[model samples]
Target: MKSKLTTTGSRLNPSQRPAICLGMPLYNQTRFLPQALDSLLAQTYGDFNLFVSDDSTEAGPGQIVNSYAAKDQRIVYHRNEYRRGLIDNWRNCFELAGEMDYFAWVGDHDAWHPRWLESMVQILNTCESVVLVYSQNVNIDNNGGILDKKIKPGISTLGMDNTRRPLVVCRQGQGFGNMVYGLVRARALRQAGVFPRVMWPDVILCIKLALIGDIHQVEEKLWFRRRTDRFSMPRQKRALFASYRPWYFKLPWPLVNAWMLTRSPPALAGSETGPQRNLRFNLAAVYFQRWWSKFGGGSWIGSPHEWRRGKATWIRKLKKFRTAVELKSK
Candidate 1:
């Protein structure tokens, strides 16, 4: 079994580097920790390190980390005195990452196919513009039975698409720019600033990483996102949605509008990958449109779903774009 630790805390060189670091932020993943560790051990990419931050109360989570660390020095484990929640746990995981040429993260309940790293890492090693890579993960049940596949778009999007090759992203009618398939870069991540203590740190970090290079999507289901209720769906969108739902959302619309107007940078309101950047920029515009229609005024039709019917008949993936707008309906 390959270990998830880097023996020497060195960074990867430009050419054929020998290390990859997988930063995994976990809470009380005790139910699936063993299996998750098993999957990491089976990864085809050999040299790597795993830094795990456990926010699980009691010693259960710590024991799981210790058991794995004892066997594999690459698995560095740390248990927090108190729960750091999602943002802090993931932030600490990245901070603990050793010098790495490539970087990725796995949810504690998520399992990866053996070739997950081998495939994505190879692409990053060869592609100059590519900063991150991820695959179409299979959503599964607790016992590891496949439940459903992640439905992705048909064509390359401006700021988005499903797991496949490195490309910019796009938004269907629902909107674009929130692609959280775990395609990330160590350099990009390091330079992008730390993940904010927000709901969707993953999404926020991915957005910043996209600004650095093209995020390649690998069209394989090597990553298994277990839907056991501990966590489902990526933290990006859900976090943002949650952040805006508090009593503060009830604050004066004029004040909310002013915050965006005052803070946004004119040069870059999006990603670095040209197309994806534009997609992200416009997607935010769509979100704003809906916000104003609801919060700012009362008459804006951001119904990409209804608009999807306007698109050509051969597109089904536009539904994912529509999914983003469901909140508006409620």
Candidate 2:
């Protein structure tokens, strides 16, 4: 049977919008989709709407979504006629948020604890100034078995001033970008411009959020991320930008990200102030310096072995920077 979604032809009024929106971008991960949907549907918080945007070439994912939507009206499924790549699918899911108060991007391959939505909603409700709230994560294998790896917690811009927040985010290399999976204020997410067209757009979005409002992290391990190292830069570039030109792969992605950070904030009605604009420029400079140290210094390019070696050096610097930030904050 071919899977399909009955598109809601009419847009809901602002008053009719659900209080919370979970935008889930799905790909061809049919084997894990059931677990992901089960985890989400089991959330104790029942007031939210789950928008699943499928970009899979096969019917498997859509079938899974259809099965779940059959039982849960809260699940609003939308299937693209053609493949839209990863980032575009994410954008499609985000578009489903409309005017919801709180919004979150749920990874189709990831599983959340039953209290994930409940805990995040409580934090967002309590912390009026917080634009995002996330819990700690536990790494899991493809089989859902726990992986024995040390997982670092994401940066929580709790007491930090908005001006200095982006600096912490810019330097919090690698895995810190996972904060995008955390629940975020719909207004703030819109102000951050959702996802930019960059290599690590999630990192850029996090920096933008840092500039707008506070970010909180719950201590409990509520997110279970399926870990796999089968990463291909070219494949990711195609998936992210929906581009396949040879020159596109050669472009300095982090440098491009730096330039994006300098641009004026998204043109959403009430956006960044002059000072925030200046701060974003300063953060861009920080990003440029890091990019140079990684690429210009000949540290991040060369053989695969050299790449691993260069990454280790960057990780060391990240730890040092994080330690300094923690000490200064104290």
Clashes of each: 20, 0
Clashes of 2: 0
Worst 10 residues of 2 by lDDT: 1-10
Q: Model 2: runs farther than 4 Å from truth?
A: 1-18, 243-250, 268-274, 293-330
1-330, model 1: which lDDT tens digit per residue? 011211223334657574677778776668888989989988877688888887776678779889889999889887776666666666778778867666677788878889987877766666556665667567789998988645443222223332222222312211112234354666676665546443334434554454456555566667777877642223432433423354544564434432332222334445335655454455445434443323312113323443445432223355656876896787
Query: What range of 10 consecutive residues in model 1 has the weakest lDDT sum?
Result: 169-178
CA error at residue 214 for candidate 2, angstroms:
1.0
Could you tell me the C-alpha RMSD of candidate 1 in Å? Answer: 10.7
lDDT per model vs. reference? 0.57, 0.76
What lDDT tens digits, residue by residue, belong to model 2 across residues 1-330?
Answer: 011212223444446544899999988888788889999988987778999998887889889899889999999999888877777788889897677889999988889999988888777765666888888899999988999987764666666666766687677644545688989998888878888766777878887887778777777899999975555554565677544433543677667778788877547435757776678788998887766544432233433443566454466677699999999999
